[model samples]
Target: MMKSSATHYGSIAQFFHWCTAILVLVAFMYGPGGPEHRVYSPVHEFDRRLHETLGLSVCALTFVRLLWRTIYTRPEVPPASRLMVAMATAVQWMLYLLLLALPMTAVIGAWLEGHSVTLVAGWEIPPLFATSHDVGGAIASIHKWLGDAIMWLAGLHAFAALFHHVILKDEVLITMLPSWLTMGRARTGR
Candidate 1:
């Protein structure tokens, strides 16, 4: 049950998928948005640290997920248009790329701006790069844009899954659902 079968994703892959989604959402919520002064201000310190911690966790989990994907077989794609398949693959990779890039940009921008990368439990990573406020500001702006992009793309992904479940009446969404949930759905003829 830990490895994906031809018809469904494994429990492990499901766990990684849902957990990463939750972490990304929570991190986005905690992010201290606004100008640099406001973001690094003492008033937003806890939120900032929590956001960084979650972002870093997402980055690490993404790497593990990639490793898991390589080692385990994923469910075969259900019947769909070639365009749909291509879009799904593109979205998947974009999500992975965003997962890695978001945290890296945060760390790099903070370092370039001469700010410490603070995390939970008072852990801090001091600036490693030479101070370049202008460039750091630019990167930080991009990070914000990327954060918004991820949320929108994730929403689209969810919509596509729902489209498959309700409109297309396919197994695409069910394949990602927990076994118990899917079993209940089957029993109810839903």
Candidate 2:
């Protein structure tokens, strides 16, 4: 039940996939302060806290998902070119790496600035380093750049999914989608 099938993802895979996807989207939105990025500019303490919390959650979930991927045989992505399959695998690994590194960079940046990431009601996660404004600023810059890069990469990933559905006319997207949602597509072989 927890493992995936050759034709589609199982419930467990779907759960982690959708949960992480939603959280990642939320973290991205809050990470840059969304529409307020221009008007608000610098991230405020509250937003920073929320972003860190969400990022940490994403990191944890992604780790579990990676472990799951290893324990279970991956569902085949139908038939695709070798090059395309290789590229898809590479992109997936990159996303996993980014999901882990982004939070770590944020944590280091916070620590260097002499701060611990906290959630509502004072659930605090301490930093791994001591205060050093210079080091913090340098790390923060890398964090900012990497976060932006991930966002762009994520967009490309979304576009690719759409391409699979619209252009490729394959089950690539449906396999990851909920069974109920894809029922009609399956019956009609769409």
Give the alpha carbon lDDT tens digit for every residue of 107-189 in model 2: 78767866677764558877775689778767777777778888888788888889988999887888788888987876985
Each model's lDDT: 0.95, 0.78
* Residue 6, candidate 2: C-alpha displacement in angstroms: 1.0
**Per-prediction TM-score:** 0.98, 0.88
lDDT of 2: 0.78
lDDT of 1 by residue, 1-190 (tens): 8889999999999999999999999999999999999999999999999999999999999999999999999999998899999999999999999999999999999998999999998999999879999999999999999999999999999999999999999999999988988887778888
The numbered model that scores best in TM-score is: 1
Best by lDDT: 1
Q: Candidate 2 clash total? A: 0
